[model samples]
Target: MPSDVDSTADEQSNGYWFRRGLAGIISAPAFILMASFVGFGGLAREAGWSAGEAAFITGFIWALPSQVVFIGSVAAGASFGAIIIAVALSAVRLLPMTVALMPILRDPKRPGWVYYPASHFIAITAWVVSMMRLPDVPRGGRLAFFLGFGMSLTVCNVAVTLLSHQLAGTVSPVIAAALVFLTPMYFLVALWSAARMRADYLALITGLVLGPVFHHVDPEFDILWAGILGGTLAFGLHKIMERWS
Candidate 1:
């Protein structure tokens, strides 16, 4: 936790983001991002991506789900427009993430356009840390901290992707696949942290139950159906739970 200081004393400086950005690399949870990206790198190459392409995806796209959608669609021979639409659809989850954290990271002096580019970096690992840590960080330092944090993840992931890409041939498929599990595990834990209400708890439980069943029945649209039906069930269950109590 960080100490509270007079906000006026903490007013903006160009250097504020620089200092916090460095500190973000050493953040305790950051290794989770590194591990997740390392797995992502491995999976990308395993799925037939080149080192250059993997690095580009990590650097620019930055979202694991979007990257997965892009690669999966491309491999399935989806059309150009389809690939873009699929990737964008998979990335819909990010809007809430960006909207949720903007207040902490937005700076009045920087103008709104800067935030759009800044929002590009709002993947799950970094977003979780920002939600948790930004409140304690000085108001002026949040954007820099976020950008720096993102930079650290980007730099490390690029290197990790290259390294993992090399290892893709030598490494067993099982081992490489195991590494890729880190990202989802991070999301599950973070979801647990965020699921404080009855509705949220029900929704998570519903997803856990329905997600696999949906996949078994219809693999193509499994996740989409799981979200829709699971959410509806949870919403109904939450109402029941509310009335029962």
Candidate 2:
């Protein structure tokens, strides 16, 4: 009977991962990215780029913010050197995100080279969802789950970029452009579910409340200031709560 019970549990674990991995393929953020791609496609078309350039940019650049900066700089008649600098600056946020996420997703035995390809999938949407869900995932299944989730988003991104290029000329640019805002909106909702610690929750709330205010004062440096202020306050509040408890 004990052997039979063990077998049943194993089967259940397998089924759980199978279903969970499949669920990642059609996750909410995938749709969010699809909507955002419509805007990217529109931007490419508006820039008078061909569908190939749109596809290449989505596939190669991958980061939406960098892509947006590239488009904007080119449209404004910026020099090539300035465009490169702006796009690189827009992507500076990724370094910290990569640092935070790699340990959670990496397998010690898996060679470093594997991460080269895998790193491509570490976009904000995937990282946010993966960080939140990875603890619940069986350790061995984490990579498989992320590959499925990340691949789905990437494939959808490429497809939508190509399709958007054609549709951008015909579709309402304003509506599609507005959809790009969905990424941050979803981040707010996702953070609500994912925040477990008081410090984390407080930090998130502070960022949300003060983010627009800081941006109003200084759009260029708002994120850095908000992060510093929110993080410091959250740490202090958490320490106070711990001492009181």
Candidate 3:
């Protein structure tokens, strides 16, 4: 349907694609992300964050993991420098995501500075959706579509965070915690659905196997080490298999 639409005169208009992208909010991933942020709002309240602070973090950071690390660190009375380091470490994963996404969204006619703000929207949800959807869109309209989807999602979630913060006390801790798991579940399922290569499957499986092992070894940096080691091993194995083939 997108390919059919792209072949028409609407292909030339950014506004058309942008408005179409706005429809992403109605999708499953969007709902999952909103639910996760509701959980985040409850977590923030339990951590003693103000509603304004929670909303600000949601708007600016936009990465749920980083927001969690930030609030967790602050609540635990970590030093300012330590909080910054922890959050930055948690968010470093986004750099590669942005790099992977830029080729699809970049318009050579536009200046590079335009991508800087767009980069802020490069969380897991936006990146996953854009990677799947942008190839079908005309190159000229990809940025507009992404901006429409990402900006709208971010705005809506910010409001959700604020509202959830106000109603945080009403939600039982167990349910709120369960809500937070929905995003990762969606992410795993989406990745599986989108996988096209053996290497992709290998990487995912390796990460899954290593995650708990690394957690048992060192809880503080489990995710970081698991991801790095698992991804590197998968990549190396893929290369070896390719050479043998």
Q: Model 2: per-residue lDDT, tens digit, 10-37?
A: 4346445645765775767677667767
Ranking by lDDT: 3, 1, 2
- Pick the lDDT winner: 3
Error of 3 at 70 (Å): 0.8
- Tell me each candidate's TM-score: 0.79, 0.65, 0.74
Q: For candidate 1, what is the lDDT?
A: 0.76
lDDT of 1 by residue, 1-245 (tens): 45345556566543676567767777667776676677777778768889998988888888877887687667767678767776876688788778888877776656789887778778887888889878877766677778887877777878887887777667777887776665577557767776767887888888889978976887555555676789789989999989999
Candidate 1 stretches with Cα past 4 Å from truth are 1-12, 72-90, 181-187
Give the per-residue lDDT of model 3 (tens digit) for 70-166: 8766776667876777788778868878888898888776799999977888898888899999989877788889998999899999999999888
Q: Report the CA-based lDDT of candidate 3 relative to the real structure.
A: 0.81
Worst 10 residues of 3 by lDDT: 1-10
User: TM-score of predicted model 1?
Assistant: 0.79
